[model samples]
Target: MKAILFEAPGSDPIFTDVELAKPQSSEVEVTITAAGVCHSDLHVVSGDWDIATPVVLGHEGSGIVSALGPGVTDLSIGDHVVLSWVPSCGTCRYCLAGRPAQCSLVASVVAPLGVLHDGTSRLSKDGRTLHHYLGVSSFAERVVVPVSGAIRVRMDAPLDVLALVGCAVATGVGAVTKTANVQPGSTVAVIGCGGVGLSCVQGARLAGVSRIIAVDIMPEKLELALRLGATDAIDSSSTDAVAALTEMVPEGLDYVFDAIGKISTTEQAIAALGLGGSAVIVGLPPTGQHARFDPLALAEADQRILGSNYGSVVPQRDIPWLVDLYLSGDLDLDSLVSARRPLSEAPAALVDLAAGHALRHLLVPSI
Candidate 1:
């Protein structure tokens, strides 16, 4: 298998050939078909997120179930599945409470994967152990992922289009539909016109939002946001976002989704809230990062600041429904794919992702 090795933070990923291993009793080995180059992977690759070195970095992906481990009867060989960053344990306080993303089992398993779990990973180069990223390191030809991290989808769904569903799409849509509970005809303003932000725009549209406003620094991205369903676009690089939106909606929007995960954006989302408006946080700021807002305004206006992780998605149910939406006229997955290339061209995709040029760059490994 050829995998992207994270040598250190702020360094380019090193692609290398490695060994292969069978699936564990609770795991499945997937033959990687399509992997989306997401900003989250860049966050790890940039070493902003603390993780052990020599790890494979990628989470949003979908592929065929090449093999299954013992006790894995729910899935069969050749089933198409989408990989989620969240690894859920069916028997947990959170999982039992219907919050799988908050499943406490993740921290327990992260250490092993970081140091090549299983005492020996199928990944290695020159006899050196390589760590795995996010439990589903989709940046390779194949990866061993826990069953909890996969959501089986219809095999017929276009794999390339659904790649965004793994992360960006799921997060964006989840923020609107699940986290914010966006009501039909609600006014929305999404900060950040990236993949996830654009998905939020589309999700708001699906929820029948009347005024979908997009804010971003990139002109091209703002254009993409309009195409994705944004009724209005604002280039924050020049104009004052808060002031501009204030002019549009004097009392503020019903929902403001801060997909950038920045302290400043959080503050803006909070300040721009309507009398009973809510602001949902979606970006992954580095660990320990914090944001500040006015307590007086929150109390006076009945405002709320919420944080959404993985779009509060139950992948098994959500991914399939999203697939159906794409099949129908609801969700447009094909439009999210800005470009596609073979797995060998993954490095270039990462570079382009860093440049903020595309929604998602899909990697067809078997291509």
Candidate 2:
């Protein structure tokens, strides 16, 4: 199979042919249909997070099941599915508690080891083992994922759009509906209108928020946010985002989401919150970076700061709902797809993503 291998940090990935091992007993092999070039992938490629090198780099994707290993009875060949990077062990403490997003098995083992739950690589090239990125390396023509990570969806759902639901959509919408639980008629502001931020705008609109404020340094993104669902937009590059947000909502916003994964935007989200309002940190900033907040103000105002991982999503529960919303013409998945290119163009797509030149660039491996 052809895959993009991240040979080292702060370097471009090498596109080359690799060997894929067959699925294990509980795994499923999928022929990649479409994969979204996500910011998280860019972060890894840029060395923001110290991930293991010689790994396949991708997570958000949709595909058709090509084969199933022994014991994989729920899915079969030809089943269309969306891949979840964070696959859960159902018996783990977190999974049992309905917080599968924080499954300890994945956090303690699979992530650090960069392998399957069984602690082995399923990909290799020239006799060298390649690490898996978040257990769903979809930047290739095919991938072997744990059955638990594959959520079956309707075939009618566009694979390119479904690709976004695997990460960006799930994270953004889940943050609003599950983590912050923004109430109807409330005021909300989302900083950084990237893929995740735009989805947050759409989520807020779906939740019936009276005012949805979109903040970003990019005017094009702000305009796109308005088209998605934002009631107002702010050019944070030219205007002070915090001041503009404060002036827009003197009492503070009911909910604020920082989707850029930066300390500055996190602080902005915190400062813009109303009394008793919650600030949801949706972005994954580089490791070791921290945001300072006013302890006294938080105590007096009863404000809350919450960290949302993967939008606190349960893939099986949320992906279908999002699909329904998309089918109903409520969720705008089509607009999120800024461009589509073949697998060979993935390297350049990653560059454009890092340069902030594209939104949800979907790599159609079959193209």
Which regions in candidate 1 have their CA more than 4 angstroms from the true location? 111-122
Total backbone collisions for each predicted model:
0, 0
State the TM-score for model 2: 0.99
Task: Evaluate residue 317 in candidate 1 and report its C-alpha lDDT on the 0 to 100 scale.
Answer: 78
- Top TM-score hit: 2
lDDT of 1 by residue, 123-151 (tens): 56678777767678888899887887778
Give me candidate 1's TM-score against the actual structure. Answer: 0.95
Instruction: Note each model's CA RMSD in angstroms.
Output: 1.9, 0.8
| Ten contiguous residues with the weakest lDDT in model 1 | 111-120
lDDT of 2 by residue, 1-367 (tens): 9988889876788778999999998999999999999999988987889887789989999999999888999998999999999988888989999999999989987777789888898999999999999999999999998898999998887777899999999999999999988899999999999999999999999999999999998889989999999999999889999899988899999999999989999999999989999999999999899899999999999999999999998988898889889998989988999999998888899999988868899999878
Q: How far is candidate 2 from the true structure (C-alpha RMSD, Å)?
A: 0.8
Give the best candidate by lDDT: 2
